[model samples]
Target: MPDAIDLYDPDGYVDGPPHETFERLRNEQPVYWQPMPDGTGYWAVLRHADLVAVAREPKTYSAARGGVVLEDLAPETLAMMQDMLLAMDPPRHVGYRRNVAPQFVPRVINQLEPRVRTICREIMRDAAERGDVDFVHDVCAKLPSQVVGELVGIPEADWPQIHAWSERNSGGQDPDFSSGYSEDASNATIEMAMYAIGLAEQRRAEPRGDLTTLMLSMELDGEPMTDIQFGSFFVQLVTAGNDTTRTMLSSGLLALLDHPEQLAELRADPALIPGAVEEILRWANPLHYFRRTATRDARLGGVQIAEGQKVGMIYTSANRDAAVFRDPHRFDIHRDPNPHLSFGTGEHFCLGVHLARLEGRVFFEELFETFPTIEQTGPARRQRSNLNNALKSLPVRLCAV
Candidate 1:
C-alpha cells in the first residue's frame, strides 16, 4: 500500500509503464506482491535474474497449472490453453516443441526473406500512397497478417478477418478493441478455432506444402494431434504470429522516430537494423508479462512462494533491470550482449523469434529505403492493456523516394 502501484490495473498502463515504480520495486521489493480486483493476486518477479530463474524452473512454477495470463480463465478456456505452447510445461512441452521446432529454426525461417520482403515492399508501397495514415492498422499490421496467412495457407480473402480475430483475442483488455474482453475473446477464439478446424479438414483431404499441413502431419507423444489440438495450435500460431509481429513493427518504428538520431543511424547503415530491432524489443517489448502457477513451495528472489500461487515474470521491468544492463534505461541500438527477456528464455522461448526478427529487420530496411521523408503526423496513442504493451494508433506521414 505504501507505493500505491497496482500492476493489475490496465488503466495505469494507458500512457506507458511506470518505470520509476518498477525501478523502486526492483531495488526495494524485487519480488513484489500485487492484489487484483478479483480478490486474487500475483507475485511479480521484477528483476532480471529472478525472471530467468523462474522461467528456467518450469517444474516448480508450471505454466499449465494456470494459463499464462494474470487473471484465471474459465475451465474450458484453461483446458484449451493447456495445449498451447505458452501453457505447457516440461516433458509435454519438450515433446511438442521438438516436433515443431525445426520449422522455425533460423535456417528455415531465413528462407522466408524473399517472400517477406515482397510483402513488405507491397505494404510500404501502399502506405507511401497514403502519406498520412494510422500506421498501427493501415501500414504496420498488413505485412504480418498477409505473411502469416501465406505461411498457414489461410485464404487471402480471409486475412482481414483473421487479423481482426487475433486483435480481439490479444487486445481484449482494451475496450476500444473488445466490447467485453472475456466475451470478445471467447467469440473470437471460437470463430478462429472453427476456421482452423475447417482449414485442417480441407488440408487433410488435400495435403499441401504449407505450415498448416506440416503441423497436421506432426505427431506428439507418438500420436497424431486431434482436430481440437490442431485448432488450438492454429490459434496460437496465427494470433502470436500476427498480433505480436504487428506490435513489434509499430512499436519499433515509434521507438526509432522518438529517437531521431537512432533512426538516422539506422538509415545511414541498414545493417544496424537488426541490432535496432533487438534494442526496440528491449526498450518497448510487445507483451508486458507472462504468468506461471507455482506447483510447489519454492523460494525465488529470497521470497517464499507457496503452491497454487500465481507468479508473473514482468518482462517490462526485467528488460530494464540495471543489474543486467549498463544503461538499462537508455535505448541504445548497439547494446552488445543484450540479454533482454522479450523473446523469453529456455523452454517456452518464442517459437517465432527468428521470424519476428526477420520481419523487423526487413520491414525497417524497406521502410527507410522506400520512404526518404517520414515524420510523425500526430500523437501516438497506446493501447490500454497491462498484458499488451503496444500502440493502438501511430500517426505518420511518409513520402516515397
Candidate 2:
C-alpha cells in the first residue's frame, strides 16, 4: 500500500499526474471518503462504472442538492449558482441546455474549424517570432478566448476582460489566479454577469450574427431568458470553454513532449491529429471530478449513499480504471475506442464538446506545421486548486520553418 492517505488531501496531486495515488485508491477504496477543510465530507466515486452510474441516474443523484462541491456554498451563493446550467435538475436543466445545444451542434462547430485554424496560426506565428514564449498564457489561452469571443460576438478588444473574468471565476481556490476566496470569486462572477447583461441588452436592441444575438433572442418555455439567467449561462460557457480547452492544448503539448515517439508519429501523419486529440482528453482530462448529491438512498458498487449526501464522479480515477481501460496508465496516441469521461456522460455532457475538439485538432495541426523545432524550455506550473486541473505556465522555445 502507498504511504499516502489517498483522500487526506485531494489537492495534493493537482500539479502533475496522480497515477500512483489514484491507482491505489481504485484498487482499495473505490468509494473513498474525503473530509473537506470545512466540517463536511463526501464520497469520491473512484471507479469507472460507479461514476457513470451516478451520472446516468440524475433523479437519484441530483446536482442541485447542497451544490456540486465538497464544501457546500452559502445558501445565498447556492441561490446565485442555480442560474448556471450545471446546477439545475432535469426538466429545467434539459430545457436550458437544449436551448443552447443547437448552436453547439457538431455541424455548427465543424464550420468553425477554418476560423479555429486561423486563430491557431496567428497565435503560433506570433510565438514563433518571439522565439520563446509562455505557452499557456501567450499561446494556449488565446485560442479558447478568441473562439468564445467570436461565438458570443464580443469584440476582440474585450477578449482580455472576458479571459480575466473567466480566470477569476474558475480560479477562486488558486491564489495566483484570483483573490483566493469565494467572496472574490463571487464578486468576479457578479461583475462578469453584469458585463454579460449589458451585452445582452445591446444584442436585444440590434441583433448581430453571433451567439449573444442568438441567446438574447432565445426563449426558454416561451419566455426570454432573464438577464440573470443569461449572465450565468454566459459565465458557464466562457469559463468552461476557456480553462478546459486551454488545458487540453497546453497539457496535450506537455504529453507530446513527454512521448517524442508519439509526437513524431503525429508529425509524420497529421491525419492522426484528431486521434491524438482524443488521446489527450483521455490522458489529461482537465477536471478531477464533478459532484452530484443523492436525492434518496442509493446503491452504487454495493455501497449505500444516503439522501443529501455529496457524491462525485471521480473522472481522474475513472479515466484510469483498469476495468474500463487496458493499460490505463499508458499514453498511447493510437489508442482506439477511447472512452474517457472528460466531457462527462449522459444528461450533462459538455455542450461545448464539439467546439473543444475542433479547437484541439486545428490548433495542434497549425502548431506542428508552423514550428518544426519546438522544445519545452522549462517546467510547467500547475493551477493550485482541486477543481481546475490545469497548467498555469508552460515555457517553450519555437523555431519556425
Candidate 3:
C-alpha cells in the first residue's frame, strides 16, 4: 500500500513528519532497514536508547567514515567534510573541539546577553513597525546572519551574501530554495570556503580581537589550522548556527500559537521560557536524522549491522519515544526530564548548545515583552526536505505590548 512508507522521499514531510509511520516502525522495527533509491540501504535506529548507544560508541559507529548524511558524497566532498568537526572521528575530533570550546562555554556565552538583548530589541521594534512580516526571513533569519558574521569578523556589508550562501547550503532539497542541490550546494560551499580562507590570510598579517583571530591563534595537535581547514570550519559554524537557530525560532513560535494556553503560561512567567525552549527543541527538533557508518559488524536494538552500512540516529522518531517522554505528542511548556537528542550526545554533541539555548530564551522573552499578542497572519509553510525539518515561511501580525 502506497509502496509502504518511503522515508527518503522529500515530499513525504510536506504535510508534516510521518509520525504514524515512524511510530509503527519504532514499535515493530526499532532497527528498521530502509532501502534508498540508489540500491543502497540504511538501518534507521528509531529508539531513544538505541541512538544514545550509537552516539556513545563512536569507535563502533563512526561519523567520519561516510560523513553524516545518507547520500554518498563525492570523494572530494567526503574529504572536505572530514576536516569539519561534525564528521571527524575521535582523537582528531577531540583535539579540534577543544581548540574553540571555550567560546561556547556558559561563562563566555552569558556575557553576550546584553548584546543578544539589543539584537532582539531591534528585531522586535522592526516587527512592531511593519506590523505584518514573514517571520522566517524578514525577522527570525536576520539575527543569525548578523550575529554569526560579526562573531567571525566578516565585513558587515557581506553579512547578507554570507547568509544567502548559508541558506542555499542547507536548503538544497527544496526546489523553491534551489534549482539543483548538488551544484548549488557545492558552489555555495566553495564561495564560503574561499571567503573564509581569504579572511584567514588577511587576519594573519593584521589580527583583530574576534573569534576569527582566536581560531587563528589556537593550535590543534601542536599545529595551526590550514587555510583549507579553516574554510571548512567556518562553513560548518555559519550554516549550522544559522540554519538551526532560525528553525528553532520559526518552528517554535508556530508551536506556541498552536497551543494558546501554553503561550499564555509562558507570557505570564518569563522564567519558564528556558524550559519552554527545551520543550520546543524536544517536540520539534531542527533536523530529522544524522547518519553514522558502522565501523565493524555489530548488533544494535536486536538488529545486526554490517561494517560500513549506513546507520541513522533518527532524532524525529526518538524524541517521541513513549518509553522516554511521557505524553510525547502533547506540547507542554513544562516538559521535565526532557532528554531529547536534538543537539545529539557524546563527542558530536552540538558545541553551540549553550549559545542556541540563550538565543531561544532571550528571543521569546523579548518577543512577549515587545508584543502584547502575536497572531499568525496565514498558514505556516514548511521546507520540503527530509533532512531539514524547518519552516520556509511563517507569516505573523504583532500587537505591541
Flag regions of model 1 displaced more than 4 Å: 1-3
How do the residues 1-401 of candidate 1 rate in per-residue lDDT, one tens digit apiece?
38578988999999899888899999988999998998999999999999999999998989999989988998988888887888898899998998888989999999999999999999988888888999999998998998889989998999889988999998888988898976798789989999999999999999999988998998865899888888999999898898788889999988888899989998999999889999999999999999999999999888999999999999999999999999898999999989899998978999999999999999999999999888999999999899889999999999885
In model 1, state the lDDT of residue 156: 97
Say which candidate scores most in TM-score. Answer: 1
Can you rank all candidates by TM-score, best first?
Answer: 1, 3, 2
Query: Lowest summed-lDDT stretch of 10 residues in model 1?
Result: 1-10
- Give the Cα lDDT of each candidate: 0.91, 0.85, 0.90
At residue 86, candidate 3 shows an lDDT of: 95
Model 1: what TM-score? 0.98
List the lowest-lDDT window of 10 residues for candidate 3.
1-10
Comparison by lDDT, 1 against 3, better one: 1
Estimate the overall C-alpha local distance difference test score of candidate 2: 0.85
In model 3, how large is the Cα lDDT of residue 292? Answer: 97
Candidate 2 per-residue C-alpha lDDT over 1-401 given as tens digits, one digit per residue, 9 for 90 to 100? 54456453536865565777778878887887776767777898989888888898989998877666666887877876777888888888898888788898998889888888888888987888898999999999999999999898888899999899888888887788777576678788889989999988888888889988888777765798787778877887788889999999999999999999999999999999999999899898998788998899988776788888889788888999999889999999988899999999988898888999999999999999998988999999888777777899999998986
For residues 1-401, could you state the per-residue lDDT of candidate 3 as single tens digits? 24577888889998889888888888888998889888998998999999999999999999999999888888888888888889999899998898889888999988888988899899989889998999999889977777777788999888888988888888888888877965787778889999999999999989998898888887765788788888988999999899999999999999999999999999999999999999999888999999999999999988899999999899999999999999888888898889999999999999989989989999999999999889999999999888999999999999895
Deviation in Å, model 2, residue 34 alpha carbon: 1.0
Which scores better on TM-score, 1 or 3? 1
